[model samples]
Target: MSEDHQPETGEDETVIESYVAGCPIDPELAGQIVRLADLPWNDRDVTDSAMRGLGWSDDEVPTDEARFVTAAGHVVYGDYCLYLPFAHSYDVGGELWPDDFWGSLPGWSSQRGAGREEFEAHVDASIDRFAERLGPPECDVRTEGRHLAIGRYSWRYAAWRRGGNILVIGPALDGFSYAQDEEAVVYIGEFAKDSPFPDAADFLNLMHT
Candidate 1:
């Protein structure tokens, strides 16, 4: 299932929140992330234009700042997902950084296959890595044995707040006409003011975990 649409939960449910106080960042920087992530994920150019309209520059995205390129041809750039469609995104807490995203880039080439178990282990390690930056996660859990469109799957994830935006480190998976593959992934977004769900707990309930 695609999370392309906003969902409304039927009733009150527990919300996930971090009891640990978040480390602070420059308010302006946090605002930029919030605004950028709030843009529609369906289009890169559209999102870029919207970000620019709101005074964001492509230079501000953390891909380069964070050195998110892999020697394996995978990249963690904004809109990279548009080119590489993953099958099991959000299926479990995190995804595989699937070998599917491996392809030729100007100065980059990928092996086209990475050990799934190894990559998944790396995804799980992200919580501590992120904690180093964002202080502590508001919520981190392994939702094993959760039902999905395919079958039961288990994944772990961690969430941190960078100001108004909610950042999550989770495994991703997806299936298409040809095959299925997993991807390493993270998420940063927030509920809209008019959103039906208020916090992570409410929004996550849609997963029915």
Candidate 2:
């Protein structure tokens, strides 16, 4: 079946709850649900094996997508159905680094907004820091001007890196405007342990859970 097909568990009622509440669905749970829906048989042996492989008990697993919304009202959508874990933010300070005593560089201004050059520099610095902490395998960087394609939004640029696995960053937007000037936001996504760019829906689905 196509990846976009909603799992049997994702009912209209669940969609309503997610929309009204603004809660994200859990992707991990969704993955399990999708697998269950696609199962050829309902036999105990077959179900048990699949559940075991997913590291979940049948009862613990969600039967449909409706069960995904959290009390906070986050809705998981897309391949992995992963939610944006924390509120979106351009302020990477405390989130990405806690004890590290590094400040934004002089040439880089998160305030003036980052251009291609500035963005590239910032990502390079981030790579250096990431490497220092995790050690490095491989890395690459790219930048572009504003452009809109998918949907109506315009992405400033896109960056992809591969070390132990794939790490994507870019198309940073005006978080304040998007969140009504209340919350800062940035779009970042990680792929499977060693995969490049996750199956979009699967990745988003995982985040929701």
Query: Highest lDDT among the candidates is held by which one?
Result: 1
My TM-score estimates for the predictions, one after another, are: 0.43, 0.27
lDDT of 2 at 20: 7
Write down the RMSD of candidate 1 (Cα, Å). Answer: 15.4
Score each candidate by Cα lDDT: 0.40, 0.29
Residue range 1-209, candidate 1, lDDT tens digits: 11212122542223211111011123343344445554555556765565456443444332452223322223334442212111122211113221212221322222212243544555655555656555777676665445544456666666654443456665554323132344545555543343333233342332211
RMSD (Å) of each candidate, 1 decimal: 15.4, 17.1
Which ten contiguous residues of candidate 1 have the minimum total lDDT? 16-25
- How many clashes in each structure? 21, 38
The true-versus-predicted C-alpha distance at residue 166 of model 1, in Å, is 0.9
Model 2 lDDT per residue over 89-182, tens place = 2222222322111112111112222233443344344444434433552433232222432123222222233322233323233222322111
Best by TM-score: 1
